[model samples]
Target: MATKTHRYRRVTPAQLQTISSLAIWIPILFAVFKLKTGDTKFRLFIIFLVFGALVDSFGMIIYYFLSNELFDYHEVFQILYLWYECLFFVWLCFFFLNFQQKIVWRNILLICFSGLFITEFILRIVISSPNDTYSSFIYSFFLVTSSFLSAFALLRIAENTGEILRYSWFWILSGIFIYCFSSFFVDMLSYTAIGRGIWSIRVLANIIQYGFFVVGLLKMNKAQ
Candidate 1:
């Protein structure tokens, strides 16, 4: 008889952190876009995030009313969640073009995120629901990877300017750190009976993360 081998897959805490950081990007993207653009051209994107946020929150609210092992509503909620999830990457791409950096690595990262979005779109179509395929690896990867690089660049800029504390990078970095760390618990919570409770933490973290972005935006306005 031949021996059989079993393969196991795992997501590291660090990876989970990256994934969780995605929650904050929705609001951060909105704040930055509103700050940068004056016209109504990108207004639709802003509305998308707002609508997605509302849909996601509504889904959470309805989750509490669902019965065990008979979540007929889950299917509908998952569809909305998947759609809401796509907005983050779209905003990230828009934000990247407005970023202050002009380096080869940044360009490569932008390209990678764009490619990931395309892959994610296809995956969403194939899966069609969070229950079918909820990992959202590509989205998490893009958000986390881009955040890491952007945070580093901002830190460097802060250092070179000799005004680190005065710069917006400090707040942005702190927000990213908090958002990333919270993602691990959020992911674990998603699979448990108490998952919704943990997801509440994710919402709190998002609020803080977006607050930091708002602070950064105000700083930019002051510098102008």
Candidate 2:
């Protein structure tokens, strides 16, 4: 859900470090190809990918160099990332609402969520903890759960239940759901001893998400 773990500023193995950095690009490359084929649906996803790449790249790598000279900028970048990620996921949830009324409610929820995000960001800085893991956990839990429910609701109302699996959005949402849901758990567990060091679940969840994304993107090609 966040770099709450500092992207494991602690991984010693070069192979794993390389793999972790590369994992995000898997979905980005697929999304880029989809956009190249003239599919506009993935355009927002493209932006999401690019933003994520920048955030993770700078936060995980560039920050290391920064620590040598300037002060570490934890409050802004990571906090901004957490806020953006939450908003994006919530908006993705909004995209799937099949009914106008449901969409309206989601809009209201979006506003509320935005306000909440702002509040959380401020709290993270004010709090004594290095990372506001608790507030972050709240965001991940709420947004991911809401998005999951939105997707589930779509499944319930879909006329062509059998064909639902063939749609690109379904798999994409499912991948996001699985990834974010796992992240929510990771955020919660981070408060305990079990959450010490780097958790493989984050890496595993990320790969699984993009794996489903590859399937989802391929389905988009087929649909065209």
Candidate 3:
């Protein structure tokens, strides 16, 4: 009897997207890190970006190894990645809120949203699988809400400070707004026909969003 061998197939479009984005991100992140040596305001955002990139890269590696398995860990990785994504956006919102001199409103909203997120997370874990549609919906909703709230807060600050266009956070919030606005609908209809049609659109939105992030980092470098 002859031994059997398996040949790996070409990468999928999603995997290609991850690889391409990382290629763009690595150099930009390095430049940003060098420029933001002592900047504290963007520390958390930078950490999140690097971590997200690593996770995405690891996910692609897992895909290559377990692509043929019936009960592989790829779905688990995806769930964990989605959870991190939601949590990071929440952290970003809190970071933005810290800019406000008065903490009362920020505290109230933070408490409420945090509670809601915890409750939803528990429900998701107890009642659904990691790959549940409802879990994705909930996570996407949280991200979208956090992004919009952050954008609103940044705008309020810009209005009061009178140099909104010059602020790096303005561009960051703009990117978040574009990505989350498009993603909100995608998440809602992720299992539907419309979702399939909008998949390319979502990818385009993400690319644009990350482009804004690069632009924001460049502006910060100039400002410094």
Q: Model 1 shows how many backbone clashes?
A: 0
Candidate 1 deviant stretches above 4 angstroms: 1-102, 126-134, 188-197, 222-224
lDDT by residue for model 3 (1-224), tens: 99999999976567657755575475356546655453665766676676667666666665556454522444444455555556556555555554555456555655655665565555545554344475556756666786677677676767665676676677777777788887777777777888776676666777787877776666675453
**Residue lDDT tens for model 1, 157-209:** 56566766566545555565565556545554456667644566666676676
Query: Between 1 and 3, whose TM-score is larger?
Result: 3
Q: In candidate 1, list every pair of residues with a backbone clash.
A: none
Error of 2 at 92 (Å): 2.2
Clashing pairs in 3: none
Task: Compute the lDDT of residue 116 as modeled in candidate 1.
Answer: 57
Error of 2 at 86 (Å): 2.0
What order do candidates take by lDDT, descending? 2, 3, 1
Candidate closest to the true structure, highest TM-score: 2
Please report how far candidate 2 places residue 187 from its true position, in Å. 1.1
State the TM-score for model 2.
0.74
